[model samples]
Target: MIPIDLQILKYIFMEKPIYYFKMKPYFQTSEYHDLCMYITNRSDTQNSDRLDKRDYTVFDLETTGFLPEIGHEILSIGAVRMNGNSEKLDEMHQLIKPIRPVPNHILSLTNLSRDALNQAPSFLEGFQRFLTFSENSTLVAHPAHFDVRFLRAMVKRWKLPEYSPPCIDSQQMAKYALPDVSHRLDPLLHYFNIHSLERHHALNDANMTADLFSELLLIMKKEHNITTYSVLQQLLNRQKS
Candidate 1:
């Protein structure tokens, strides 16, 4: 008959018990298990840090006018995603047809005439495409309030649920990151050494915003150590309050 100690050891090793055996030996008698355990624990801690990365989408809208209450509508919407460290992913851009005619003043500003929008889909269709492309990612915009207001209005008109995704306003970020300077997009781009190409186009503006946001995120990460979504949300709430 097997010795009682050996039998207990065999049962602990071979029974495949329901609960984990923390005291079980993990290495051969000739090897050290403490080093292995330390390595495993360190790997787990590193993986936990990696899991806290952030995801964001930088976007821009070219509108037919300024105020939504005064019948302004979005003419085009463009966006690009960024992973934890501000690495950009694929981009999305769509031209939208407004419910009302494009005014001469808007045409002069945006250079998008009625004929250009004639071939495009309606605002609802364009917004649906944009939403699908975004895949529920957090949004970043230069002046978030205007773009968010327009998007919220479109969603409401289409009877869709409200979009409550996390948002980062580059304008606000600029104010916080560079307290002494003007917070306009062009100036911020210049400060970050991001070149501005097509000034008023939706896609170009979106790309520029992405670059600016990337630089701003690097700054935030280095200075504030903002590595998690909850921390970012708290900072934004504090800014709002």
Candidate 2:
């Protein structure tokens, strides 16, 4: 027979498992229908001919889990509007209440509380406000795959309007521009000598990403002559291949 304390430990672990982070993807058959079409059908009018002349909305999200299909939800969004590589036009930050309670680890990581989130607006209201702030600017985010995927998941779940902005992944941009260095935000921040923001805060991260992307834009223009959205896409694709 097991010791009493060991038995209790086993029962606790078995009854209430803690997911420190999600590793497995939660696949959905509808993802292709719900998410892929948005990418496929992005409006050509939204793509700016010149990178240096374009307007962009650089954004970030704090979420409860990695995969949205498994009930993971967005906790907050942070974004900034920029004109080309030089001018920052505006900023936006919003907290969204999830259907489930915020986990202890997430609360610690984000400096957010269940009480605060409980008082916040639902994802629909907050995201709608963000869309208004974003307008029709090109969407920019570090690791666009994660943030955009989460946003698309929410859009699908909420039956919101199709998100049609041309999206750019700043992380991929960094990887293409500086193929030698680490592309994670912290190392890139250090590499570019950009000042660090409070990590895990959505707005701060967005601001940092915007700054990093601006630097990258200048580099791409001067070194690679990547002047247009089409050229930028081609460069990124070549890097992937």
Candidate-wise lDDT, in order: 0.68, 0.80
Per-residue lDDT of 40-153 in model 1, one digit per residue for the tens?
Answer: 343111122331265667899988655553345789998887776667878988888766567677777766778888789866467657766665467789889878877776
What local lDDT score does residue 59 receive in model 2, on the 0 to 100 scale?
97
lDDT of 2 by residue, 207-227 (tens): 999999999998989998888
- Model 2 TM-score on a 0 to 1 scale: 0.80
Q: What TM-score does structure 1 among the candidates reach?
A: 0.75
Which residue pairs overlap in candidate 2's backbone?
A: none
**Clash count, one per candidate:** 0, 0
Q: Looking at model 2, report the run of 10 residues with the lowest lDDT sum.
A: 18-27
